[model samples]
Target: MNAHPLAPIPDADVDAFWRDGVICLRGLFDADWIEHMRAAVEDDLAHPGPLAREYATQAGQRFLGDIGAWAVKPGLRKYVEESPAAEIAARMLRSRKVNFLYDQLFVKEPGTAAVTPWHQDGPYWPVQGDQILSIWLALDDVTVQSSGVEYIKGSHRWGREFRPIHFGGDTEAYKMLPGETLPDIDAIRREPGSGGLEIVNWDMKAGDCLLHHSMTVHGAPGNASSTQRRRAYATRWTGDDVVYAPRNGQASITIDKPTIQPGEPIDCAVFPRLWPRPQDSSLA
Candidate 1:
């Protein structure tokens, strides 16, 4: 955590994260870091990795998404290794050590009308635990109207799982198996605070980020803004409690080789540990 460019999270911010399952740390990353990441995102979009999922011309929106950019982009790898992001995860999770999960890059071009369905991230992931969290950094200034993600506060405590929604609006997955669909988005908007549900959102500038719990119910509106493009990178992290629980029939970008059991601790060349100050702790 060498002179972590990010500011140390205050007690209030930590409290907000734990209580609300989301917290925004303003300017935690410097302009240089943001620029580096933005460049990486632009370049990656231009070249495009095998994992990149882009909308076709007929989709009527320009939404491009990719996972696991660290393996393909050097700038992303540098930010993951050097930035204060891991330390932030450690302090929030209250864990002695942390692991880099993976990278998610989502870009919403102007006038994009695709809505990211409201859902919890846990049901879709192979890893399972309460200590999962993601740091979403803004590459450009964004507002709630401009496609910033919104979270239903305290939803992480609901302790229920829902079917994962594919990016292209296929509702078949949720229809196949049943848990509970995200508490009706339209109803919540109509009757706010009716059932302990308070929707929280933020207007963010470049270098600002929202750290959200993995289980938090979140989604975003279409990029309604006519001019501004919404580019965000979400880097996930895991703590001591996280484990490999690969769900049958789901492929994870984080997992590549070897056979780690369902309940084994996650560590290796993949999911690299990032906390307790690796070199300094090794010396200690």
Candidate 2:
């Protein structure tokens, strides 16, 4: 499989990423990668990793989540290192280099009614930087009825990190960084004269993906479709500005503590450098 994007990322898409804090790039990944992820997702469902979770849901519904699969799953590791994802992230972030931070899986079985609450991805990690983001690759066709994620357009420029939302887990390890409390988004929408807070989502195909800022407030409804499954593979990537800064109450996703010191570039064994290939000494 070619490890490069089938088409060059257009300048408009890059502008959208910076202006709106999110962009849905279509047909970026070839069919080969999508099938590989589908197989990996099935295997992960059967034998979940340490951080795998079965979130609370109503009867006949299932919401499964897992993180840091790249550390143990060869398929995911290959995708991170060999796919055009790193290049895409670097271009979107406008950074000269990039690093593979981690990967997460969100599987909402048909009829699942577990809603992902509104929250930002920035505060959930033990790092800090404006260049951090995630590429959410759909493993199956996705629609609003099938739990397609919705993003608060331009929320990343809000310049504030809301408290992380806890979804029925051991909250002991999940602590909040210094930030504003999460606003009642639903209530705000119900009231009049509310600031025009727009939410955006799209119908996505198996090979399409959404690139979103780390601070973009986003969430998704349950898999309301009775027969369609909603499975997505979200890979987090960091650019040159990101650094390791372990914090208390962070998401329990880092399988092992990074060997790098606080305030150091996240370029240790856990988060390896991806861009500027060693062979391409010219770029380096």
Residue 211 shift from truth in candidate 1, angstroms: 0.4
Span of 10 residues, lowest total lDDT, candidate 2:
168-177
RMSD values for the candidates in order, in angstroms, are 2.7, 2.4
lDDT of 1 by residue, 60-150 (tens): 6788888887876888888888887888888888788898878888999989988877888877777878899999989999998889999
Model 2, 1-284: lDDT tens digits are: 55778889989889999899999998778898989989988989898888888885477677988889778888877787888898899999999999888889999999888888888998888788999999999999999999999899999999887878776544453554566778988677666754478888999999899999999999988888999999999999999899887777676665776889899999988888888666864322
* Candidate with best lDDT: 2
Clashing pairs in 2: 175-249
* Alpha carbon lDDT of each predicted model: 0.80, 0.86
The regions of model 2 sitting more than 4 angstroms off are 169-176, 192-195, 280-284
Q: How far is candidate 2 from the true structure (C-alpha RMSD, Å)?
A: 2.4
TM-score, structure 1 vs. true: 0.91
